[model samples]
Target: MSELRFEDVTVRYGTGRRAMKAVDGVSLTVPTGQVVGLVGESGSGKSTLARAAVGLAPIAAGRVLLDGRDVRHRPARGSGRAVQMVFQDPYACLDPRMSVGDSVAEAIPRTGTAARRAEVTRLFGLVGLDAAHISSRPSELSGGQCQRVALARALAARPQIVVADEITSALDVSVQGTVLNLVRDLQQQTRLGMLFISHNLAVVRYVSDIIAVMYLGRIVECGPAHEVLTDPQHPYTRELLAAAPHRDGYAANSAHEESGAVLDTEPPDPHHLPAGCRFHPRCPVGPLALPARTDCLSLDPAVGAVGRRHATACHFAAPLPTPSHQAT
Candidate 1:
């Protein structure tokens, strides 16, 4: 299967004085039968990058290539290029008055009522929903069911790649887990390439094969999910894992008991980015830093290989000690 690749892509919105680059020059690859988890704080351009894959976001520079073909030039949906997106809020995309089945059926590119119904039913089954849900309206279903419907709709198109943009962020914690499992199962069964974007690193970790960390429109780190999560090399990535709540009591759920010294500074505006290292101002490794780099403020860091399948865009990238290795 052909992989979906972002080759030094840059996405900008608006023009001139009001212009903002939502996604800076970035590259990512999502191969079939794998899920690439994208995690970062809100407005970090995770969704924008995913949108680019499906031709939803504008590409100011570079290209979103699927199997070596640009999405814009490829077949729209039924032709051959099948890239579908399940949005964050299903309510916004789903017609409230439409029945769940009909919502999904709308995406099925088939002719005649019989063909449509058959295809929709197949999609429903694929997404783990029973035929009973066909007549139920969106308002009558739980958030999890709504999300399933959205996925079913995307599946109806027979997409090779699926962009799930914060699809579970709206559900309850319990429901979120259930939805994530469904997604994982579906991906494995279909061997579909997936771009799973989320702010919750835990959720990403549970579903992704590889993880990419974004910050203010640029990728700061990308690597195997285990390495990026357990032994993040980039400072920003370390900050994210550090800030993530840990179970100090469950395994030991003392999550609330441990403190992570996270920087709380406001991010720079997209329209006016910092001149050098985008993260310089708030970097922990400043003048008081060990292995400090006096040129951090003047030198922009590019993504460099740190290990096998691991890359970080920081000059002083180093892995943080795991909880077991750190002083309690």
Candidate 2:
């Protein structure tokens, strides 16, 4: 099985004093046949990290490896590329003038015209689109259909790894579940290593095998999906879970009350990141709930293992008491 690994990857934009580390010292792996959900707030660099995997973002340091081989120097687009990305805006990715069939066909490796057309039909069906709509243009499809077409295009390349960046966030609430279910189904059937990026905790929980919680440009916590959601160790992870809409008592059962107030403030400027722990200023368990720890303000905490394969990057990382309202 193939594996996509981000080894201490750092993505920096601009140069000199203006440079911003959009993804900082992050290491994570997505082994084929499993989904690793990357979740965080809007500016938490989740998208940047996804872009880096497909070579859309420049890496200032570290490497993105596919099966232990560097992917930075490899082709990031076309059929030759092993990594494919499904962007958030599906319509934007498709050409308005091209027939949806032709759009998907563009990613397939060269073959006989009849064979290519057949492959396009098969891909459409794989993504749950009607083969009859193959000739339809992007303007003729609904938002959900367009997103599925985008997914079809990505899969047409026969990629080893797929990076889905908020692929369902653009669709209607009713449509979101359909697209998500299709994704989960496709992943299971194809066993493609997938990095699913979203800010929605509930959505991540629905499709992910493992979950990585990012904050600022760093991953603050990560573990099996169940463990991270049920017993978050980092302050940011707890706050993120609490902020999610209640689902199966998961959100409501988070250690929010003990973790402290909701995160109301915006994160610090990326260009002028705070010293020490980057989340110190807004961390509920730190300055917000108790006296600010000097370590939190002046020293960056290294990620430490809290459980089997579960890790958190906080000096005070510990399991909070189970919430009283937790579902049995």
Candidate-wise lDDT, in order: 0.80, 0.87
State the TM-score for model 2: 0.92
Model 1 per-residue lDDT tens digits across residues 1-328: 4588999899999989999999998899998678999999999999889888888888999988888888778564544347889999988889998898888777777568999898888888888888898999999888888899999988887788899999999988888878999999998888989999999887888889999999989888898887666666666776667666665211111222223232566777878888667876666554324335666666777734343235677766643334566677
Candidate 1 wrongly placed segments (more than 4 Å)? 74-81, 247-262, 287-292, 303-309, 318-328
Instruction: Give candidate 2 misplaced runs (Cα > 4 Å).
Output: 75-79, 252-256, 303-309, 319-328
Top TM-score hit: 2
lDDT of model 2 at position 91: 94
How does model 2 fare in lDDT?
A: 0.87
Candidate 2: pairs in clash: none
